[model samples]
Target: MVDVEFRVVSDRRDGLLLALGQTVIAAGFTLLRQRMVNSEEGVVLTMVVRGPENGLLLLEERLGTHHLVNSFEASPVDASVANAVSAPAAAAPAPAPAARSNGGAPKPASDDAATAMDTRRVEALLPQLARDYPNIFIQLLALEHDLPPAQREATLRYVGQRVGTWVYKRDFSLGGHLALADAVRHIALPAMRQLVQAELQDDTLRIKNSPFCHRGEHGSSCHFLRGMLGGLLGGPHGTEGLRVVESHCRNTGAEACCFEFHA
Candidate 1:
């Protein structure tokens, strides 16, 4: 068993960085302990993780890929914890089709396909594309010029909702009968696989970790997700009035990215 430890101290608090830390845990590493010690210099975070031989490589890759921190140093630690790294990944439950809560639309064909697109692949390529060609998001943002500030935000949110609807319709071929809560908790997150881990309680859906928009560090991003949630609950045949509001964002310095859905 190999234990690798690394620490990061940012001059300012960054939720994206914290989210990356949580990502290490979500990625199936065994977290031994963590703490934030205050000092005259700044905020210091010391985290210890236990894993197999590739632990350091994985950590470095994750941190470097996301550009979360400027620098980090890792060293081997005594393996005191037993079998922590070998723990199996948690399996997400399948989302069952049900009657639409709002009775909005008709049902569609919902079945498992022999060939399914690998979401992890898509997730990886997207960020790389964004990094390689920053103009992608720039072009998306350029559309905001046509509308006023509030209207621009609202429009983008609506666009995101439509994108969610498209995913449910074309990508998943899901029926309108899926319950919003179940859709988010099961279908959406599971389909996303390692991209994110979340908890949905009532109308609030909290993301513990996500690689999207560089974990929301993209700043003024995830408009599509905001819209996606809206469409997921209220699209087409669904009558449930749903709104998604991200309360905490890694881009803005919160440990987790939270999306609150309310009628």
Candidate 2:
């Protein structure tokens, strides 16, 4: 059995984690063991990955592609953990028609169709958002709460985030619902949740020992465990604001999604 390992220290307590599961998803890798430790220097992350070498390379590319690695001081992964993380999640790719938690499934998008619109969905969503409202989408991403399951794909399919209007060329990926939710919900999220909650519960531990909770944190740090939503929007950083607005735009485009905000 091929295995790979990485012991990484980040100056930021939780760098790359926001995008870690997402990275695993985009590269189609399976997460084995993931632990984050808070030390004097910063956050220390250890991950076990199992997948094809090509797939692993793909993930490395995304680490750079998504700015996840730059979020911290990432070192080259040891071969064992690298091999482990590179192995595919399933012997076969999850057959299309990915299921929704509600026992529903989306019609399999055709192979010819773009997976997440080759990043164009983000390309379109954020610039238009800048055109309409600046600092909103990024602020929304800062919220721990994600777009509700019902609206996640649709909303993500229409939006993006970038540094500036003309600089909209750099956009956060507005895709990966099927992969992110599934990967974390089953494999990664459980442990990540435990680690964060343990830190929060230990009142003796302050600041340095705490995981950074997004915006106005509720009872839970992990969104899926107890959910990350906060009281129908209208809180600091508007943690639940995006989800509240996204509800009306089910399967709609950005213009339609945005108009609902004003209308």
Off by over 4 Å in 2: 64-66, 70-246, 249-263
TM-score of 1: 0.38
Q: Candidate 1: worst 10 consecutive residues by lDDT?
A: 106-115
Q: Please give the lDDT score for candidate 2.
A: 0.34
Top candidate (lDDT): 1
Scored by CA lDDT, what does every candidate get? 0.49, 0.34
For all candidates, the clash counts are 7, 18
Could you give candidate 2's per-residue lDDT for residues 1-263 as a string of tens digits?
23445455565644355456545544555454456778776677666655576666566666545543434333445666564443333432221122233535332223322243333333323333333232232223422133333443333322221122122112212323223223223322232233333212211111121222333433222222111211111122222233322221212221111111110
Root-mean-square deviation per candidate: 14.8, 17.3
- Give me the candidate number with maximum TM-score: 1
lDDT per residue for candidate 1 within 4-107, as digits (tens), equals: 77776555554533465555654546454445565565666666766567565766687555544555667776664433432322331212232343654222
Q: How far off is residue 226 in model 1, in Å?
A: 1.0
